[model samples]
Target chain A: MAEMVFQRTKGLQDRPFHYCPGCTHGIIHRLVAEVLEELGVLDKAIGVAPVGCSVFAYDYFNCDMQEAAHGRAPAVATGIKRVHPDKVVFTYQGDGDLASIGTAEIVHAAMRGEKITTIFVNNAIYGMTGGQMAPTTLVGQKATTSPFGRDKNHAGSPIRMSEMLATLEGPAYIERVTVTTPAHIRKAKKAIRKAFEAQIEGKGFTMIEVLSTCPTNWGMSPVEALRWLEENMIPYYPLGVYKASEEVK
Target chain B: MAKVLMKGNEAIGAAAIKAGCKFFFGYPITPQSELPEYMAREMPKAGATFLQAESEVAAINMVYGAAGAGARVMTSSSSPGISLKQEGISYIAGAELPCVIVNIIRGGPGLGGIQPAQSDYFQATKGGGHGDYKMVVLAPASVQELTDLLMEGFDIADQYRNPVMIIGDGMLGQMMEPVELREPKKRNLPPKDWATTGTGGRGHTNVINSLFIDPAECEKHNLKLKAKFDEMEKNEKKYEIYNCDNPDIIVAAYGTTSRIVKTAIDKCKDEGINVGLIRPISLWPFPYEVFEEYADRAKAFLSVEMSLGQMVEDVKLGVNGKKPVYFYGRTGGMVPVPDDIVAEIKKILGGAK
Candidate 1:
C-alpha cells in the first residue's frame, strides 16, 4: 500500500517550472494555484502575468491567462475584470513591474477600486533582468546594477509598497507575508485566499505582497537564501495585515 | 434614424455605442475631452463600461485588456496623449486583437498647442507605435464622416483583427453638424475562440499574449502579421475623387483640410482654372491608384495639409515622377481657408489653365 502525501494542484498545468532552485516564485505560484482550486473558481480564473520572472506564468497556470507588457499587468487586469465581472481576475507582478515602472497603473487600479486581486512579489531585486537593482531593493543590498551595495545617497531607499498601498482608501484587503518557514508559508497562503475572496465577493481591489527571495541574484545557496530572507528581508518588510475593509475583515 | 445635430466629439461617442462597442477606456485630453465626457454619460445608459484611465498609456492598455477578452473596445486621445499610448498600441497590433482608436489630432512636436492640426498624419499612417505594424487610418473631413467612420471602424478592426483609427482634427471635433446615426447593426463577427474569457466551456486553456521570446518564433509571428496586412492593403483602400474629369492640377488632402480643398476647387472653377481633388478616406490603405489614374492628366499635384507637408511625401510616392508634386501647408494648429488652398493651387499651376 502506498500513500500520496503531495501532488500538483489541478489549477496548475502539466509543465516543469522554469524557476531556479530556492526561488520563492515557485512557492508563491503553488500557493496561488492552491487558492484558485480551493475556491472552485479555477475554470473562471484569468490571470495577468507580468514581464518578470513569472512572465511564462501563462504556460504554468491551468486556467486562461494573459501576458501583459512590462509593468502594465494591473491595468490589464482592470480591463479584464471590467469586461467580465463574473470571472475572477488577478495580476502577478514583481518589484520592478509594480513599484517602479508600473506605479501609475497599480495606484490607479486600486484607487478606482477595480474588482481584481494582485499578487505583488517583492524580491528586492530584478530577477528576470539579471540582478538589476529594483525599486524595492533594500538600502545596502548588493545587486549587479548596485555593485556599490545600493548607496543610500545615490540610489535612495527601498520602497515599502505594501504600507504605501494600504494608505489608499479603495482596497478591500491588503497584507504582507513571507514564505521562509512552514508557519510563514501558511500565513502567506491565508492572506492570498483572503485577497481572492474579496474578488469573489465583488468587493474591491485587493493585494498581497510576498516578501520573496532571489537565491541566484542574492548569491546564496537555497538554504542560505531562506536564512538570509528570515534574518534580513523579514525585518525590512514587516509581515502583517496592512488594510482590511469591512467586506474582507 | 433621423439626422440630429451633434458635435463631432459627441457624435463619435454615440457612433461607437451604435457599433456595439460597450467598453470605452480613455483619458481626457483637449479637443477630445468632450468625447470621454460623452461616453461617460452615454455608455452607462447602454449598459456599457466607461473607464477614465489614469493616463493615455493606461487607457490604451485597458483597451488591450478588454479587447483580449473579446469585448469590442475603444480609446481616444490627442497628439501627445496618442504618442504616450504607442507602446500599448504596438502590443495590441502584435497580439492581433481587434479594437478601435480615435485620435482628434492637435498640434505637437511636443504639446505645441490644442487648437487643431493634421500633424499626426504621418504618425497614424506610418505606425505610431514601435515594431512593424499598421493601422487602418480613416481621415474624416467633417462631423458626419467622423460618426460614420467610427461605426464602420470597429467592424473593420474585428474583420481583419487589426487596430482601426479614426483621425480627426480639432475643427471636426468641435463643430456641430447633422448626423443620421446608423441602426445598431449586428455584424456576424468571427467567434473569439482564442480570447482569454475562460477555459470553462473550452476543452483547452486560451492565452492572449504578445510575448515571443525566441527570435525564430517572433519572426514567424511577424510574417503572420504581414500576411494579414497584405490582405488589408488589397481590399480596404478607400478614396474619393472630386472634379477630376479634366484638370490642370490635382490636390491631395485628407481630414479637415480636404473640405477646404474642395471649396478651393470651386473657387478655381469660378476663375476658369480647372482643378480637382483626391481625398483619401483610408490613410494607411492609401489610394495610390487614384493618383496613378490622374498622374498624366494633371500638370501638377498639390498636397494641402495642416502640418508642414507630411502627406506630400505620400502624394509624391503615389505620383511616382509622372507629374511635379507641390506642398502647401499651415502648421501649429492653423487651419487653412479655401482662399489659401486656391492661392497655393494657382501658384503651382502658374496660369497654365
Candidate 2:
C-alpha cells in the first residue's frame, strides 16, 4: 500500500473545476476550502457566490451556498450572518462584481463592520462577461470594452480595494495577496486563514483580496500571465496586510 | 387582542410581528417610512432583526437573503422606492423565495409627489421587474384591512414560495384606525428543507439559486413558476361585493379609491340610483369572475381609479365586451371626492340611456 502525501480538501465537492485553462480561480477556491475545513467550520459555513465566473461556486462548495445577483453577495452574506450570527458566512466575489457594480454594497458592508468574511478575487478584468474592463483593470491593459488599451485620463487608474477598505474603521483585518508561485500560494492561504480567524473571533469585517490571473482573457499563456501579474500587478497592489485591528492582532 | 387605535404603517409592522416574521430590511421612503421606523423600534424587543439598508435595491436583496435562509422577512417602500426594488423583486420571484413587500403608494413617474396615488397599478399587477412572473398583490383599503392582509401576506408568501405584496396609498399608510392584532390563523407551512442554512453534515449541500444556464431547463423553471401562479389564481383570488345586485352600473375599484367609491355609492343611493361596487382585494389574480357574473345585469362597468385608468384594461378583459367598460380617474397626487365619483356615475348612467 502506498502512503498518500496529499488529498483533496473535504470542504470542496468531488468534482472538477470548470475554470478556463491557466485561470488561478481553481487554486484560490481550493485554498479557501482547505482553510474552511482546517478551521473545522466546514459544517457550520454558508458561502455566497457572486454573478461572475464563480457563479457556480454553490456547486463547488460542500457546505450550504447561495448564488447572489451580480455584486450583491456582500448584502446576501450580511443577511445570512445576521440570521445565524454563530455560523460562518462568507462571500466569494470577482473584481467586476465587487469593485464596480457592487461598490456601494461592499463599501457599506465594510462600513457597517458586518461579521462576515469576503474573498475578493481580483483578476484585473471581467472574466465571465468575455473580458470587459473592470474597475481594477490596470490603466494600460486592453479589454474588449477598452479596445484602445485602458486610457488613464478616460478610464481612471486601477482601484486598490484593500487599501481603500483599510481606511474604514469597520474592518478587523484586510490583506492583499497573490498566487503566482509556490511561496506566494502559501502566503495567500495564510492570509485567507487569518481573515477567517479574525471573523471567527468576532472582531469585525475581514476581507482577503486575492490577486488572481485570467490567462485566456489576458491573451497570454498561463506562464506568461503569472509573470505579468508578478511584474505589473504586484507593483501596483503591494502584497501585505493593509490593516489589522488591535484586538485581532 | 382587543382593537387598538394604530397608524396604518405601525399596524402593518405589528401585524408582521404577530405573523411570525423575524426579519425586516428596508429603506426610508415617504408614506412608508413609518413602517421601517416602527420595525426598527420594536423588532429588537421581539428578537427579530431590522436592518435599514443603504437603498431600496439593497433592502430588497437583504429580504431576498433572509427569505432564502428560510426566515419570514419583509421590506417596505413607496412608489418610487418600489420602482427601485423591481430588480430584487424579480430575482425573489424567480428564485421562489418567500417574503412580503409593502408598497405605500405615492404619486410617481419619477418622484412625482408624496401624496397618495394608484398610479402603480400596472407595475404592481403586471410584472414590474423584467420577468414572466406574478406576485400576489393585496390591495388593502383601510388600516384594519391593511393589518389583516399583512399578517396573511406572510402565510400566502410561504404557502406559494413567492413574494406577496401589500399595497396601499399614502392615505391608508398615514391614517389612524382601530385594528385588532389577532393571532394569525395557523398554517401548515412546508418544511424549509431547501433553505441555505449550513448542511450540518446533511448528506448533500443546499443551494439557493435561480440561474438556469440551459434554455431548456430555464423554460421548465418558467413553466414551474407558471404552475405556482395558476395555483394562486385558483385558491388565493379574493374580492368583496358591496351592493352588487342588479344595478344600473357597476363600479370597479381597489384600495383607497374603493373606499371613496363606497361613499359615492351611498350618496348615489339617496337619489334612488342603484349603484354597486366590486372591490378587488387581490390585484394580480384580479376579481374577473365577479365581472363575468354581473356583466349582463349591470348596464355598464365604471372603473374609477387614482391613476388615468390602468385597471380599466383588466375590467375590459373581465367584461369581455358583453357590456361597455368606462374609466374615470384623477392622477398626479390628486384624490377623487365622493361627489365627483357620484357625478361620474350619473353621467355614465345618463349616457347609457
**Which candidate number maximizes TM-score?**
2
List candidate 2 segments past 4 Å from native: none
Q: Is the docking of candidate 1 incorrect, acceptable, medium or high quality?
A: high
Worst 10 residues of 1 chain B by lDDT: B182-191
- List where candidate 1 sits over 4 angstroms from the true fold: B183-188, B351-353
Q: How far is candidate 2 from the true structure (C-alpha RMSD, Å)?
A: 0.9
- Which candidate ranks first by lDDT, i.e. highest? 2
Tens digits of per-residue lDDT, candidate 1, B1-353, equal: 78999999999999999888999999989989999999999999999999999999999999989999989999999999999999999999998999999999999899899989999888999987899998799998888878878898898899888899999988999999999886535556788888888888788999988889999999999999999999889977889898888988998989888888888888889999899899999999998877987998899999989999898988988999999899898999988999988888877777554
Tell me the deviation in Å of residue A148 in model 2: 1.2
Candidates in order, TM-scores: namely 0.98, 0.99
**What residue pairs clash in candidate 2, if any at all?**
none
